[model samples]
Target: MPNPAPVPDHVPPDLVRDFSYFTGPGMCPMRGGDPQGALADLHDGPPVFYAPNNTYDGYGTWVFVRAEDQRRVLQDAETFSSHRRIFEKALGYDLPTIPLEIDPPEHGAYRSLLNPLLSPKRVMAMEAANRARAAELIDGLAAKGHCEVMTDFAFPFAVGVFLEFLGLPQSRREEFLGWADKQFHGTPEERGEAIRTVIAFMEELVALRRREPAEDFMTFVVEARVGGRAMTDKEAVGMGALLFVAGLDTVAAAIGFDFRYLAENADAQDRLRADPGGIVLAVEELLRMFPTVLMTRIAACDTEFDGIAIKAGDRISCPSMVANRDPAEFPDPNRIDLARENNRHVAFAYGPHRCLGSHLARRELVIAMEEWLKRIPAFRITPGTAPLTYGGHVFGIEDLRLDWEVG
Candidate 1:
């Protein structure tokens, strides 16, 4: 583990806490771990605390534990810049993850250019393909009556749909998955290598699309104009790289968490199975209960928020799991209510920097759950075997061996 950075002089010692997404309680790898739920205790302390060594690169950050406070911090992008340069260390220079890392006004153009591609209507048009992919994977696993949900269905289903949207051939699924695994879950050196590998792939893709334009996403990007000019190589590569990284892991982790919940809570599974219409609402509830992404921001300049001192260049972490469980935000924050109503959870972060692929991700989760419940009967964690989960920049599940009677 990287050494935690020294706390800044401006931060109050009373407000500093020893917590991090990498090694905090319930954050470490464990069987049947509740990485999200474990942080609910934060609400009992200060709503905002300084956590030294909070990031993958071992930097201190002000941890915001309340939903409303997080909303203010995230929405006020001017004060809390989103230009985190998340891939800087790995790539050996600054390469903002476009739209995601770009702050407002300047961020608007890129967002507008890409929003239509993933709007609700566009996602609806892709529903058949998404559902088909989910069904295909589930059907293949249904007969076995037991399988590792993450590898057998979740990763393939989510990554395949994303690949299709990106206009990449399915033949490259394993290769992309390998890179995603190393990129998101590997050692620092491995992560840097994976980051370089993905950028190289995207660079090649941009070059290919420029030479041989096709009816695919990269083609459209290469041809499309932003600010009345075609996108530059770096811009194009950033767009593709962001999509590649964002699209691969998050939805799959969600599917794993959702299935794990259903497997453990048979009543909830049976309820959703009996009333398939409820799956949409149930998915929202599940997303609220088990979000995997952590939103981080850099203090654009020295600013005071909620009476806490923040310094320029300081990292700020707004964990979705922590905010979703804030008592002030949800009525019964801990309960898993499948039919939750008026749920405005920030499973996807708020403000202009909200996840661009959220529409497709939502439909994908609903379809995965709907198809799985419809095709497979009651299932549970395979006896004596545990699904190992861990917390980090992104939380994930592994060895999720679910089983059911083969009929």
Candidate 2:
């Protein structure tokens, strides 16, 4: 990036002591993943500085983004690996998550197994039922004066849809819900505890699937002797855990944000209330605009971008929240115009490593928006409550509190 207009070099005196320990290594959130602070740092300069592990994000600041450089950075994925070192170190296992951490020719093998499972046709088969389920979920909460969207609605909505797709039994609902909340969105200490709990449950679940071999994704994985030998017990457990960890929180955040958006924007809410038909595209645009989950990829080989050099093995993150809001691509980027042109956002990511569950996620969002809009025709945000924004870059939420009059 070319040099920018110079601003006065003034660091607050109190910030002086704070800066002493501030990695000065740029904006790694792991060192302390504060969205407001990170965005502040981003605005301060370009070619962002970073360390493998910063406080905001565990391996915080290394994942950096310059929206203008998105296309080229993703195109050369050979060197930008998704197999995060920090993540592997934390998990203590080199477990397979397939196309997620693999590169090129070898990656295609895993996709072969996953593609059929996540295909549009396969996903479409489940949509009608999920929509009904979503509608039912909203029906339970629509007229209430106040309700917590995440716990009462969004969390269960996404998890239930995923469980249905995997053919997992419904009895494990509370177990999965508690564990998922702690694992990703929980505090650092809580995250560690959540990981251990999830492993135990997944282990038992995988073992059961191996023995009976139901016609679910786990069964397909357990019995498929092709590509990779019938997946080991641990691998099956890990795969289930991976999907649970990745899918549930993301969908919840998206749904939660959709509600928050509508609660605040009467015009937008009115449009959808009169006709839920607008939900399909509106949800897509919302997903594009508010990326609740951040994307991470590690640089495998030394690379250069827009003249700045990225060393091999350097961890980097591209928060879709930033890319999706890019001014260059979306005119009046902040406005929630459902008709925005050239609307592809990296919210689901770019390149071949895009979300395998996109079909399911898209349908879920559509169903979620449609069902909620109809039930919640005229609702307002609770007065004296904080605004809703996805909380953190890694795992965020819409946290909207809405009330509507009955009769």
Candidate 3:
């Protein structure tokens, strides 16, 4: 039973051609080394719209700019829709994930399904608990003085927070963790195995919630309503999968990438350690540089601007990673300056679909950085290590190889 008022059906060719960012060959085509370079690319070009690569069809993007020319693009909900079917089509799932890919007024209702628990007050309540959890993990391994930051710290930290929030028991936490890790990982074959295991577990949990109705996020979600009608089981499951990825791995990537960048730049780490207050601005800068998720969205109707053509039904991707470094917005964008005030970098994106979990993510990051810097501020990256890089749909380091000391 498809919802009434089907997704808009008239994407224009002119609009598609001018909106190109993620359709081409590179990951972050602009921001890393020089902010000026980023601005030039966004400005000097013919309005930075999507252009077709020779190899692909119906794929293009216009990475939006933060400059005066396009400031309203992020806030203009009417023109830029967030209905996210691109992933479903790519992954071959007829059913879509909740909220992340959907647009208003449906997107608005779906988000209400989980927004209460993610509110700032709730996040503050979780912060102390998160700090304790971070301390426990760090204390357990502080003596070792060296570990695989990704697997040892970030992975467990992400899963533990999510599991606790969902109120999963100790016995079943690993089942959820392992399955969720692979749920967004590997080939379709690998993905199928992960999806089945995790969904089965979620179904069982849903049943348990039905019977017992424990006090947790699981119960909250199970009992969520829109216009007074309760969410269905499938809706619950779709949202389960959504939250699993949304709450867990993206946090993992954000933390892991931050560590990798800090490990490589001891000078910046020293500065951060000296001030500590730098943590907040440093957090903003890091987000500017290392937004983990890439572009999304397929246009709903024909649109045109800047002499490019975007046609209806064309697959378009909006590249956030590329946009944040856009030189027109952030001068010297590659360099991280803690004092970069008025820095309106759109790392979490803009508009109605701007990352709902931004608040929670920022809190976790601030805590994680505080704990790490307090204990291991002057650490050096392990000698003889050429840091390995991994990129797929997302970008992060495989292992942040570092050997730190505390005297």
Candidate 4:
């Protein structure tokens, strides 16, 4: 389902092209369309500008398009805080989503609990399971010779790994994904309902874990401590809710976009298929080109940035979609260079609130790509059918029909 909510009126009609911040029209292009072209135009203008409040609900953010400027905002958490309230304001949600919404000092504490669980070692350990799951999914689709990647493979592959990691029911995969899609791209009412529905389910799951703990992520979280103190049930539920929403959609979107890129660029696909060892480097470049998450911050105090005046409580939108495409940061920003050196893209973000699931996300991407190209012959979008995509808080492919020879 698409976001039926109307684009708020306060968003200047003209800013649509330059405000390539959201997923609607100007930002996310049709499959094989050019989004970076619009973002590049914005970069040619002022580095920082005021986006309208209607773009969000009651408040707007100062859009940052330059990579250097984005780093300045992300690195200086003291000036631009990541406290939960800012996100609540940006997305109109209540109840602080731990780690992501919490600022430094305390933020580090939340990361502590989750760090080892998603560490490179732990993620590496899951490689066999992840690869097994990927191969299973491709096995089901390979015989078809043609399939929609988003629903058929990407969603199931990404969400399956997460459900297994969390010890959630694999049978509820569709129900969980439906809720996640609505939460990100649905109307306000639908988004609110999705949040409530997931949180309610999480609350129940937490209670179940407390009474009869299991060997799962939820059990680990409930048994863990932050700052040497046990997390309250509310905090535990909040973390579960956060993981439910965050874990599923992000990696799924990355897979969707990565495959989308490969579908369009057969040469790149061939190169990866030829050299599996280079898949890791190829994944990094793909993430840089199509980062799905946008990092938003609130001005903690009155501040001046790049000759622009920002006041306390003002929102700052540092969209990786915009920042990663910056010519000053990545040479030939539009082209994908698998061996690009020192690719310090903010795809995983920067500072205290960087993505905790980075290790898992990387592993998932690498496994998905390697397995897909190996099983299926070279593929591309079916002629005359445009692949669908959604924008807003997160941008992703909704429908991608790929066709290949049945070998």
Question: In terms of TM-score, which candidate is strongest?
Answer: 1
* Alpha carbon deviation, residue 209, candidate 4 (Å): 0.7
Q: What is the C-alpha RMSD of each candidate to the true structure, in Å?
A: 0.8, 6.4, 5.7, 3.7
Stretches of candidate 1 above 4 Å error? none
Better of 2 and 4 by lDDT: 4
32 Cα displacement, candidate 4 (Å): 5.0
lDDT rank order: 1, 4, 2, 3
Per-model TM-score, in order, reads 0.99, 0.84, 0.82, 0.91
Residue range 1-407, candidate 4, lDDT tens digits: 33233334533444433243454354554555544334556667777776654243435667888999998899988889876362353345667777777777777888888888889998889999999999999999998989988899999999999899989889999999999987887766777788778878888988899899999988888888888888788788878877876789999989988888888889988888888888989899889988888888888888788656677877788888788888998888887798787788998888877888899999999999999989998999888876766556677776788999885
Say which prediction, candidate 2 or candidate 3, comes out ahead on TM-score. 2
Q: Which segments of candidate 2 are over 4 A away from where they belong?
A: 1-64, 85-87, 387-393
User: What are the per-residue Cα lDDT tens digits for candidate 1 across 295-353?
Assistant: 98999999998677788999989999989988898998999888889899999999888
lDDT value for model 1 = 0.91
- Show model 4 residue runs off by greater than 4 Å: 1-20, 23-25, 28-32, 53-58, 84-93
Q: What is the lDDT of residue 259 in candidate 4?
A: 88
- Candidate 2 lDDT, 199-233, residue by residue in tens: 77777777787778777887887776546466677
Q: Tell how far residue 24 is off in model 3, in angstroms.
A: 7.8
Model 3 stretches with alpha carbons more than 4 Å out: 1-46, 49-79, 86-93, 170-177
Q: Which candidate achieves the best lDDT against the true structure?
A: 1
lDDT of 3 by residue, 303-326 (tens): 764544555444444445556666
